[model samples]
Target: MTAATQPLLPEGFRELEPYVVDWALPTRQERYDMRLSKDMTELGVFYDAIAPRAEAAIAHLDTLDLDALPEPELRLLRLLFSMILVSYAVNVFEQPSIPDAGAAFFDTLVEPAV
Candidate 1:
């Protein structure tokens, strides 16, 4: 909580091998469900900060493939991600207040919050 040192996305996402920056893809469905979803009891705190429309969009989202989701969901995902980034821009970068199942994915230190 002092310095706030958790990375935002994955190492490859920040660095990238390929196709990582595409906004037309949904993040992994399980990961997305874990971080968001009010109907689901996990209710990650980061989920609390998301735009309500994005949350609704995510819930009804239909999967296209592992590499992609429907365009509507993908767009909503981008909006959700933008909200998260904004918080990191304004607040400290700490572990996303997700459930234990979700937090395990991000371990590297994020850059200092602005």
Candidate 2:
């Protein structure tokens, strides 16, 4: 589809991501449990496997103090974190929606103040 006819993502996806990141600290376990898709779609039963893994990882993460984290651990964290992020970006934001956001942007911006 052309830029003018592309769809936009659900707004909640944008709002939820940072919140999810914040939860990565204290509610790490819960957030891990909630690591559904970008839109939190039910992608079969085994899709929830990442949560416990995150919890287990965090115990080790707490020991490192973020400064002395080894490259491999960091890489794994990045990979897991990105998976969470991309779930939102691709599945939520990039999912099909009503086209015309570009038009809407221009329409809202170009219109005379009312």
Candidate 3:
């Protein structure tokens, strides 16, 4: 199966995956647009729904050596981390700027070779 179509983690992270039913990442413009609803209630609901999968992803991530993953898997891992950071910023910290939070989160990650 192609990387996008492949099951990265069976029975986990299905809801938060890109193109999934619950996937939502605000664009840089959206972050600055406070006129839009940045309600945590909806984000909380989605986070609660995906908590199990997020935990599972955390557990699975612990098992892998990041530097050893292939290019495609590394990209997938980045996606997972991006989702987690966005959720943390919006839900936990109630941060209004997704782009800033994303930049902060990724800034700390050690880049592995593609």
Which model scores highest in TM-score? 3
Off by over 4 Å in 2: 1-52, 89-114
Q: What TM-score does structure 1 among the candidates reach?
A: 0.30
After superposition, candidate 1 runs with Cα above 4 Å error: 1-50, 62-66, 93-114
lDDT to native, each model: 0.38, 0.39, 0.48
* lDDT against true structure, model 1: 0.38
Worst 10 residues of 2 by lDDT: 105-114
lDDT of 2 by residue, 23-48 (tens): 33322333334443324343211224
Please write out the lDDT profile of model 1 over residues 34-112, one tens digit for every residue.
Answer: 3333222223333343544454544555333524554434455564554454344234433334434553655324422
Query: For residues 23-61, what per-residue lDDT tens digits would candidate 3 score against the true structure?
Result: 432332322242125466655554455555656665776
TM-score of each: 0.30, 0.35, 0.41
The candidates, ranked best first by TM-score, are 3, 2, 1
**lDDT-best of 1 and 2:** 2
lDDT of 1 at 2: 46
Clashing pairs in 3: none
Name the best candidate (by lDDT).
3
Q: Give the Cα error of residue 29 in candidate 2, in Å.
A: 26
